[model samples]
Target: MKRILVLLFLVLCYTNPSVAQLKKVTLEEIWSSNFSPERLESIRSMNNGNQYTLLKSNPNNLFSAIEKYDYTSLQRIETIVSTEDNSDIPYFTTYLFSEEESAIILGTQVEKVYRRSTKGIYYTYDLANKQLKQISDQKIQEPSFSPDGTKIAYVYRNNLYVFDRITSNRTQLTFDGLENNIINGIADWVYEEEFYLVRAFEWNSDGTKLAFLKFDESEVPVFSMDRYGEDLYPSQTVFKYPKAGETNAKVSLQIYDLVTENMDLVSLDSPYYIPRLEWRNNPDDLSIHSINRHQNHLKLWSYNVLTKKLSLLHEETDKAYLKIKDDLTFLPDDRFIWSSEKDGYNHLYLYSKEGELLNQITSGAWEVTKYYGYNPETSVLFFQSTENGSINRDVYSITLKGKKKKRLSSKSGTNSADFSSNFSFFINTYSSANTPPIATLNSADNGEEINVILDNALLRTKLLSYEISPKEFSTLSVNGNDLNMWMIKPKNFDPKKKYPLLMVQYSGPGSQRVANKWNNDNDYWFQMLASNDYIVACIDGRGTGFKGRDFKKVTYKELGKYEVEDQIKAAEELSKLAYIDEQRTGIWGWSYGGFMSTNCLLKGNETFEMAIAVAPVTSWRFYDTVYTERFMQTPQENPSGYDENSPLNYPELLKGKYLLVHGSGDDNVHVQNSMRMVEALVQANKAFDWAIYPDKDHGIYGGNTKLHLYTKMTNFIMKNL
Candidate 1:
């Protein structure tokens, strides 16, 4: 009788949901596409509002084709273009339609030049004639169609060129472009890295004039990295890199006339940085955003090309610094929609064509995260906001007067939408911590569901067979602030048993790690760690975003001080929990988070027992001007802020196991950071482990790179923590 009762208890435990036998997640499966959720790739809404186009891959892995689908029926209508069927074109990965949808420009053989920049072989396909013509004989960058689709403009070898479709004539617009010296119609390394401007050119409404930025990097200092390949001698790849307080590339704005073949340089009031430029509804009115070296004061100017007049439209000043974004959009009548943090939160505002303040479109304590386009016919503007909650995003629509606002997205979590051009319908994607992404077509007017496009039901069902722990969301008081946090423990967690804690964070300014969203790739790794009897957690401290502007900018000028303090305090507070083992605390991060982790392990020497930093910036002095200066000013001006927060300054504080990793070819945060930190630790007689990946960029990823790196990291954690 005793043996039968024991067998019954064992059987009950095996069948129970809390202690069921489930498959453990592996690092190989985490890095591969095995757990990747199905997504609607490259969704572009058609002008008709009832149809949309997306890229569909062939089951045989031959090529991908662009197919049009009806929103109402959720059925594919027809294939627009196919690389497999048309042997004339190579396998194209990207497609873009002209303004009138008459022609499509296809990009093939695309290769990355840097972050947010790519060079590829491009072709122009005429829909009416079924003719495909290569735009250039060599790879080009940023090929864009003119308004009439008669000509295509692109950058090749740093020079600007225009290809006429009718006559097949390629015209060289600028001839002064040279490698690392003069860049025409494209942003240089610093601008591309910091300002997120790759194609530094724009075509006017009429397509007769082209406005482009010229980056003269002759005076900027050069940075080189040795590329070790299958050769006897390694080659050096050199390019201009402006460290903090260093000389930057002298940038100028110029306009080229297609009819007269004349290039005119626009005169301004000694602008320091021309971050953004866009043409309004009128061809003559071009709007430009310029900021001073401090990046605290920004001015929006309207330049009339025909009259050669420049006038200030609006100006914004912030005590900390302003973030330049692509949110300035002009309406049909030329009144623009802009987002700013002037009211202690990021919100939308409407401005007249002449730069007069019309009215604040949306206002509250929360933030308007995304500014979708405005529909003139219905006079309703669509956007995504955090009004529901800071961690939750919901789609919303409001009129010009901010009245009759309606929440478009039904489900909670991180909900985003891709609206049709006519604003008649939208494809809403919804996801939460436990749910995979589900996409549905909905009516733009009333937020009623029209059809379910792709729900990822299969992935959701498959996840049930895995021992994935649910994230426990809560707020923890640390350093006199309620910081957002989430934790993942073992599936069969016991209140009496203590577990080793591993805290993860990316505590950069205006960044968030803890949010109500579906699991990312890192979350899967955390789940794997939890399966190994480790408790994984993340905390968005003071400097993290979505709370408000004041909370985010509190760490300005001192990049790592408050952020590191919050992380340390949070860890210390979490150690008081009954389920947390205080002696076995560890922390790890990447990039800015790496900087934070390194500091926490040193400053919180008694707290964190181990740390892992990947591609970390050891000092602000080694970073770029635009980003670093925006936060901490110049290293020359704020010497104490830069030096004191840098982990390189105090290697003697090391009392824990540290693992430092970096890519030798890291152009953004160079390998010099890790090397300097390694030297500092060695001189201090502190034991540590480090790895340098040769010829890999900041991401440190390639064929087997990420897998091997993660495996090494896991082994280190198992051995140390």
Candidate 2:
């Protein structure tokens, strides 16, 4: 009998080794990037179509280089520049080539200023003579080489300066720039956070003129956060932050003439917001986009540099609000391509130089997610869209007239492309739920794979030794809409045994959680939970994007109402599954997702047993002006909309276990949100748990902070849910 049992055990181990050797994922490993896939970093196509440049770094020596590679051979042609060979050059992290490829700008000691703004010590390296010169003695922002490759323009201390390479002289272009009062050539805090504008300056084609925006934020309200660093006393960091309906920085567009040395402000009938500025193919003319205060009306204007006159190019007014994107592509012939949602879906439209409607370039029921570039040689335009499915993204090539639209990407999951300068070739990055990121060089004409750049085969092999669950994707009918969803069951899931269901979401406007892409950190955490016999799922509820504008904008004026309803309804529907334990349901999210989880626990108190919220905005009034007013107008105009959905007003209804967390140094969504929630819950005589990480930003990540936070959250889930 013992020999028979041993032989059976050996057979079982041979057939199912995964059961015996499968390793459970740990939070430390997740935060340590143990499962990270290899990636092609910072790929820049050279002016010559046959070659490209890659920023490669050696971690052991801390040396970095810009290596040139031939696209056809997929081999490194040469190291254009490296800190290892150049004694004068420090360890640089980023590099940008001049328009004529005569010089390259290397950025070193770079530090982030805000979400999308950075300041760094810069150097210009001449390719011909192998000469390197510092652009400024101090750190600068958005340094760009002139078209003639003679001068470099950058922003320093809110002021604009130009470095002349020929003369080796630096000239200050603007002197009125002051901290928290006036800013030149760079975006203000609200503009950077909302309109996604960082560097607010552009160089004209002829290199004789510079167009920039000046922000007078003297009257804007100031917000302060206490940064409890490793010091004796905490320091306060303050900046101008404009809330909804608050006074915004007075923005004005200005142009400087190098030949005449004169700077003049262009008047646009006192526009409320100057969001965009670009120089047309004709250096004499500049294109500008201005929006009104309510944000419903947008006007495109053409300003002549010599004439100093503005002409109305095109005007668009939407009932809801218009989103500002950097998709305005100018063709060589002066015609421009723009994307619009006039037909209920975002499609590309071609307009004449005079702003006359020529034709709709691309139209469909689905939306164009990204507008790549128009190849003038073949008149073929490439873009990524949701035509495959709302949850999936595929690359497609279309003509100028919108006919002959061909799908370039063959993958069914998330696929993005970076086209070469000549558009003859493109590098495609593809990823799916079951696959790590795979980058391949392909033909731009028909998307034929030419060479494999990186397949992440090692990461795939390492993951095979772990107990990873497959992310099953499907659609759920909830609130009369087919909502996209993905669920992860336990590795040894049994249909007869019930498991606790945890619903996760962001539920913010134009945010998607149910994407069919490779796993993120949160997805790994969900897998960890699934391995512990818990079912994890994510649903893209109403107010989420990729569906029609009507479905996404349905919750406008009421930010959290329909989204909360959809989550609660989806949870109820998911609870009906035979394998789900309806009584022990839970939810968690961060940021906007954090806001949703809090509301789900309170408003849907009967459905959710526990909730975890991280860096949540308890009220829309706490958000910035451009993002909040676009959807919910203002707190003064929409008082009921702000108060009715706010969880602060209904803290008495909280009947489940709740965990609230925030970073004390969060400038985006201040800690006042969590503090107020704490006070409200205390006043309501409710029991809950909350934590505040000192000196952490909205992301609340640095070193082992994310691991600690996840550990706390994991323990809470194991105990409560």
Candidate 3:
């Protein structure tokens, strides 16, 4: 009887009262603010890029202003700063300006100190005589402004200071800063968690030279933890973490000389890793870049500072490792502009200002995903790529001799943009997988559409009172390659019913999460696991990224070997579908997708039967050392590539049902990688379910703690899949 008329049409489509009156999205309306969305915050563009400014707030006067606008009629036009006319410091949260925008800084009460450091209560203001001042009563770090906006610098206990906007005094500048031993101008915690470095100083293209980076860390090696707050005992949080084959932190490269107050130190034929210093438009040139502790050679030097000489301008190497960005760009005849993948994909080149190779402005085989500058009076160039595919992203423009290209985003999904300092407008933003981001403003010469800045059409009419299935993206072909997936299911879905699959992934390396834009917060927690009945997917396997560089360095030195063999061969080919079920499989992830869902629940123990792993690392000789030796190069040079993709070196290849979350002050995947994978699954006796979450870090939310950790992983996926 056709399976009892398809189980009575899936029980009359769940007793259809208009599908039981729609409304299913709730985890307190996906963590409240009643579905927020209407953005365009913090903008910028002025310096005659024909005006722009933004910030905005006013919800019937709880005040917040900044305003300005008008990059070719995107409207508004004045107000520049507020909290109902700023009566001094009780209102600032952020601001910066001064490259002759005549001063601004502002900040106030900021806080956060790890993960892009902070700590604030600054304030300079003076948009021509409105004065303000403040800059110190302590709390600081990366304050800025000095491009003749007349001095401000900043950083406080780990040294570096300055202020003076007309002598409000405060010049300290480094007396061998101390803390966990001499840090100087910021960036210490393993160069701010592995070279995403946080203000280890800069200031030159005419604020009279500054450059920085000191960090001696008294021969590195510290690492402690235990914070457990509401203090009745627990206290630790130590520092200097080097990890993988340890000891780092000698790091030198200094500079400072605002009219010879002197500081010097630059001697590098291998500073081992400065990872970018920058100054370029010739104010006595700077550039820097460096790398190597086997980050496979990267150089780029140049130095100079009034002839203290250094010059080796370009060198790159890479038998698998050289990636770095913020693309360089000098060209006012200093001819720089970089971006490389050495002809295997990442494109754009043109070199010169003393480094040689002159042109290769953009090539094919996709990838660029954002470079966007160098109009040099329309010799064109601009970027953002994946030439319209690898999970979309468009906006192009080529031709610094790579000959005419074009595509300024006529969206087919994620667009991006933001221009205006003379690209004559841009803004863009866009979105897709059934759009809900819009943004607009356009016309970078031909991409038309001039206006609408943020049309998340009332968040697509409040997602039509809820129930949305959408997603579906596709690609698949499991282990032999073609990955990029995405799924969703359940809202009235059926192809003869079975469902329950799960699978999410991260497969890190060049990282991509089957992108196409919109809906994050884990896409509304994978649309609440597809409205509670399961399905959800996501793949982007084999070391993930826009298909290239030999599909992302073929998992280089084998970190989680071929991303855990392409997510256990893409969950055994999505459990040979027929509406999936395959014994209701499951998998989940968090840090490096919780080390690829604890190495696919112990090497895909027969294709996963449950897993969660929130902060997981479970050892790469306990991580950090420039992202685990840029793809596993040192545990004394790959101890069988870190104990064969560590899940705490195979806890007797545990078979299924696991949970293990973490946080106990994580500071980046350290809850000792889930208490050493719960002591190798209690010496391999197995049986799981774990969690920690006290003093949380590595994003273990703060309040209702990510809704009580997703309602305890939605009651352990309705009691273990």
Candidate 4:
């Protein structure tokens, strides 16, 4: 009887669905697209509000096509163009419709230059005549149609040119453009990296005048990196990069007249950073937004073409520093919508075009996260905010007076709304930490569901085959603030057993890691770590965003001081948990988080036992001006602030297992950061491991790149922790 009972118990254990039936997730499958969620590809809403276009590939993968679908029925209405049919161009990837929808331009043979810049072969398709024409034989950047759809303007080899789509004639607008000294109609390296402006030109409403930025980088210093590819030796990629307190490129605003062939420069008071340049509704009035080097004083100057005079429209000042964003919108009458943090929260306000204060549109303790476009026909403004919760986002609509506000998204997770061209309908993408993305069409008026677009049910069913654990969300009161946090415990967690802990964060200013969103690629890797019996936790400590302006700007002028303190203390406090193994605590982060993780392992050596830093900034002096100067002023102005928080100044405190990884081709956060840290630790006789990915960018993602990185990290964790 005893032998029979033992055999039955063994058979029952093998048949258990929760333990034996689920498969373990592998690093290869996690980094691969095997478990990726289904999504809409290149969606373009038509002006009719009832139809939208989609770029889809056939099953054979030999041809690609653009097709239109009805919004209500979710059925294909017509095929716009196809490579398999009579379409002349081969497999276009991107499309741009003219203002009147009379023509479309497709981009093929595309190549990326940076994070936000690209070069491509462009072709224009006439919808009425069904003619396909190439704009340029060579690759160009930022090919845009004029307001009237008669001409196309693009940048090539640091110069600006205009192509007449009808006559097929090209006109070079600027002739002084050179390789690195003079950049016409395009942002230089520093401006592109920090200010987020690439195509440094804009066409007016009438399309007769073109306003563009000219960057003269003759005095700025250049940085170079050795690119080791499949070559005999190696090549070097060098570009102008202005570090902190260094001389920046001389930028000027110029306007070119197409009719008279006259070009002239505009004189403005914004000498430090010209972040934004926009044209008003009158076709002649142009707005120039500027801020000082400290970024505390910002002014919006308006210039009138007829009067030829510049006037200040508005100005914003803050105790810490002001943030420049793409939120300036002008109504038909020239009254504009502006968002500011003057009231301790980012709220919207209406301002007359003549610099008069009108009224505040929205007001509350919470911040308006997104400012959607306004519909003049219904007088309703759509936006997204944190009124529901800080970690959650919801869609909302309000009138000009901030009345009759309605929440369009009902789910409690992250809800991002993409409106149709006419604002008659919007597609709301809802996701939570425990749920996949579900997209549905919502009516703009009463927030009613019109149709279900994609639910991602297949991804959810596929995820059930693996051992998964839902992330536990909570709050940690550290340093007199209720910091938001989340933790992923082992699937079969037991309180009596102690498990190693690994914490991840990206504790940059105005950044958040603990949010209610679906899993990213990192989350899948975290789940794989959790399956290996490690408790993964993430915290949004002080200096993180979404709470209010005060909470975010507290670390200003001292970028890594309070942030590192919070992380160290938070780890110390979390070690007191019953299920946490205090002896084997580890932390890791990328970029800004890497900076913090390095400091935590040094300053909090009593608490954290290991750390991994990827592409970290070792010192503020090596960072750019627009971003680093905005937070910490200048190294000359605040030397102590820069030197005190930088990890390069103090490496003798290291006493734990440390892994530093970087990419040689990281133009944003240069590889010098990790190299300096490595030298410092090496001189201190601290034992550590470091790696460099050859010819990889800051994201460090490519074929077999992420898989190899995560596998190395997993092996390190298993060996050390």
lDDT of each structure? 0.91, 0.91, 0.82, 0.89
How displaced is residue 301 in candidate 1, in Å? 0.8
Model 1 clash pairs?
none
Q: How would you encode candidate 3's per-residue C-alpha lDDT over 161-182 as one tens digit per residue? A: 8888898988887887888888
RMSD to the true structure for each prediction, in A, is: 2.1, 1.6, 24.8, 2.3
Candidate 2, backbone clash total? 0
Q: Write the per-residue lDDT of candidate 4 for residues 198-217, one digit (tens) a residue.
A: 99999889998889999999
- Segments of candidate 2 deviating more than 4 angstroms: 1-19
Better model by lDDT: candidate 3 vs candidate 4: 4
**For residue 556, what is the lDDT in candidate 3?**
85
TM-score, one value per model? 0.97, 0.98, 0.32, 0.97
* Stretch of 10 with least lDDT, candidate 1: 12-21
Clashes of 3: 3
Sort by TM-score, best first: what order?
2, 1, 4, 3
**TM-score-best of 2 and 3:** 2
Residue runs of model 4 more than 4 Å from their true location after superposition: 1-20, 58-62
In model 4, which range of ten residues has the least summed lDDT? Answer: 12-21
Q: Write the per-residue lDDT of candidate 1 for residues 1-721, one digit (tens) a residue.
A: 9999999989877676456678889999989968899876768999888888998666466587889988889789998989777888678888999989889999888999999999999999999988999999899999999998899999999999999999999999999999999999999998999899999999999999999999999999999999998899999999999999999999999999998998999988888899998998898889999999889999999999888999998999999999998889898988888899999999988999888888998999999899888999988899999998888899999997788899999887999999998999998999988788888889999999988888998987777778899988899998889998999999878989999999999999998888788867888889899999999999999988988899999999999999999989999999999999999999999999899999999999999999999999999999999999999999889999999999999999999999999999999999999999999999999999999999999999999899999998999999999
What TM-score does prediction 1 earn? 0.97
Task: Indicate which candidate wins on TM-score.
Answer: 2
